[model samples]
Target: MSEILLYDIPRKDPENGPWSPNTLKARLALNLKGLPFKTVWVEYPDIPSECKKIGAPPTSTEADGTPRYTLPVIYDPSTKKAIADSYAIAEYLDATYPTDRQIIPAGTEGLHAAFNKAFMDSVYFPCMFTIGPLSVSALNPPSERYFRTIRGDLLALVDSVRPEERWRKVQAAFEVVNGWYEKADNGKVLLMGDTPAWADIVVAALLVCARNLLGRESPEWKAVSEWHGGRWAKLVAALEGKVLYPGYGWTKQGGQS
Candidate 1:
């Protein structure tokens, strides 16, 4: 078994955003695939140093030399391979491990590929567009003072978008996700079938982020919202803390706390 090291920020507060989803997805995938790995929780503004030490790129670096970032950059110590990006990391695990307990389906690569792309467009992007701005705006003046100096670019990126438009886009995306989930599940418990698949993991991560961060009440996404709050809860709870590969723990605990 290969040793895996996941680089992510510790979930100190509940509203941390991207890092939570990134870590959650990686942990779930590892559990679903039955891989074992160690988690290395780094703080915001120091992640770049941690990344460099582990042979990974710094996603963000401050002028004062800090590296707060996202992505559970997976380092396979045995092979000296480091991978970043959530979907890429998941795909790598699925292909390399290839188990009967596969996270993404074996024969349905096309479907998974489409789902992955759609997720980025529909769920991930829009949700970030909405929450990122709100989160920054809501930060206390002193806290904002610290973050603004280091992450001013990110703050500016979200501030450029109109809040109304961001909300509308997020709503539209959730509706699309809900529709897709309804069609895929066909009133079943899981997204694809009785068993949870890679598609489930992808959507589950999206719903978790949306509901937790973007406000759970959406008239347009009622069904999807309900399903996510209900059915998906059971799935994640059942798989909590199960390791899927070396050094990676597939546990929901990383995000919830």
Candidate 2:
């Protein structure tokens, strides 16, 4: 039995904590395929150096020049390979484990890629603002600061906003996401084909992040979880036990390979 090691940022709760959506992508892909793996938590300051030691690319430029790596890096002992980045990891899994379940169903790969890109452009960033700040609170001081500095350079920090304005933006973003859900089977079914795929996983990650960052009762939570007439909530419920592959799922202490 070959095992894989997943490099991810340590957080308060693996199931509902401040986690990387990109990292969640790889974890979802692996779990979807029922692969066995273990997670190694890396501190914020260590990501770059740790990733480079495995021949991974720099995820971000560092002030101290420490290599600046990112999450979702996986090393598979069976194949003697270390893959970095979430999408790459998903693709690698698809190719290497042909007999196993796929990342995006067969034949729809091209279409799915295009669809995912469009969704990323339109919905991902907006959702980021809604959950990014919440994630920071779950991190240790150093990691939180590191995350804020890097992300803050790109957009306004969610914590800086007044409560009224914050909720308003979160509501607006939720509307946008709900609109997409409307486009996706009118919020009736999954985003892709009959079965769940990467796109669904993307939303699932968003939903999970929102839940983790915002208490379930938070207004932001209501906006996302209840928008589109409870589309997100329903979708999450439908996918709860399905997407997670066999054995040692996220519900467990360790869902590693």
Candidate 3:
């Protein structure tokens, strides 16, 4: 058995804000694999120390020897390996525990790889493009209050993007995913088939961002909304405290504060 340690922070909502997809993906993989791990929660803007302790460097660091940030970093004490980046971490877990439910699917590595690439390109890119600018714009006297304001601005941006536009892009992306699911025939599960796979976790985590942070009233998310409303409820239920932050609530279930 490998000893695993996870690092993350609460969501902006304080109730049910979404966890970083990387964190969620790693946690879900661990759960699916029936692995036990220790978790540590850290405050934002101070994640570099934690990253450094785990042997991963922060993307940026302050001049005073304080580290800026990096997230969803995992440390495996048994192997002395630390990993950052959601896709890399997920793939590592999939390969590391090959017998533990096989989230990535066998004989279709290329397909899964492509799905991941497209997912990052479609979902994460747009999200960052929209949220990043808003976050920067909300800067104030530089306090926690300012950070909260920035978070609010990002949320508002998500809300301001009309459901129609959101849906069109999301639906197109999902259609590609749906086709993959159909071909894989993994089962009736979302993303890759009847059973949840790595692709499902990736997509689900993205949807968590959209619904929990962005708002859930988009026509673009109809299929996803329905799935989350129905079969995928278990995933949400399981993630109650682990994936959703304390105050932020999930939009689909009327759980956000």
Candidate 4:
């Protein structure tokens, strides 16, 4: 058994599971590859301190030299290494585990990086602005006040916009993702044929968060879930029980599937 530690943020229902896309992506990779890990629940405010304790480098340093930290870090006890960031962690896992199922895929790191960037910018960027409020609202209650005091203020401001128009922007982004899936899928529902790839995990992480964070009751959730003929629905179903995340298994019935 490999000793692995995953550091992630708390979902609104921490007792249930995680809701961070980056962390969720890391978890998905680990689960699909049959790697077992224990999760270290890190609150928003403790990121810097938690990261420092593990000797993980900060995301950046301020002019005055303050260390800034981020989430989705993994510590491998066997190798005695702590890696930060989703992309770096995925690559590290691929190298360490050397499984037949490769998320980054052999000899395609650069291509996958570019593809992930495209999804981040085109699909996730606009969705960020549109779903910003819902995302924060899904944070554990303790962090909600803290988040609202910082970036949440900006995200909530966007919520005041007309819901229909706000949804329009998000819809356009989903269409782009759907377009890519149409190209990628041959006779299966996954991105790279029958097998689930890292790219699938990358995209699924966001949708999973969206479904779990916003909750099915919210209009934002409805619009996102319905977009592209609920294309995400099928992918969500395929990967649902394979991993344990806040929104890993959901349905319109208002119950965990």
TM per prediction: 0.70, 0.83, 0.64, 0.85
Tell me the deviation in Å of residue 247 in model 1: 11
lDDT for each residue of candidate 3 in 95-139, tens digit (9 for 90 to 100):
776773576778767877887788788766665544333333322
Off by over 4 Å in 4: 15-17, 61-65, 156-161, 217-223, 241-257
What is the Å distance of residue 147 in model 2 from its true position?
A: 2.8
Q: Model 2 misses residue 203 by how many Å? A: 0.9
Q: Write the per-residue lDDT of candidate 2 for residues 38-76, one digit (tens) a residue.
A: 777787878877887877776666677755578889988
Model 4, span 90-161: residue lDDT tens: 888899889876877788888899988998888877766755676677777767777787565576568677
Better of 3 and 4 by lDDT: 4
Top candidate by TM-score:
4
Leading candidate by lDDT? 4
What are the lDDT figures for the candidates, one per model? 0.63, 0.71, 0.58, 0.74
List runs of model 3 lying over 4 Å from the truth.
1-3, 12-14, 57-69, 127-168, 184-187, 214-224, 227-257
Work out candidate 3's RMSD over C-alphas.
6.9
Screening candidate 2 with a backbone cut-off below 3 angstroms (N, C-alpha, C), the clashing residue pairs are 36-257, 37-256, 37-257, 38-257, 48-68, 48-69
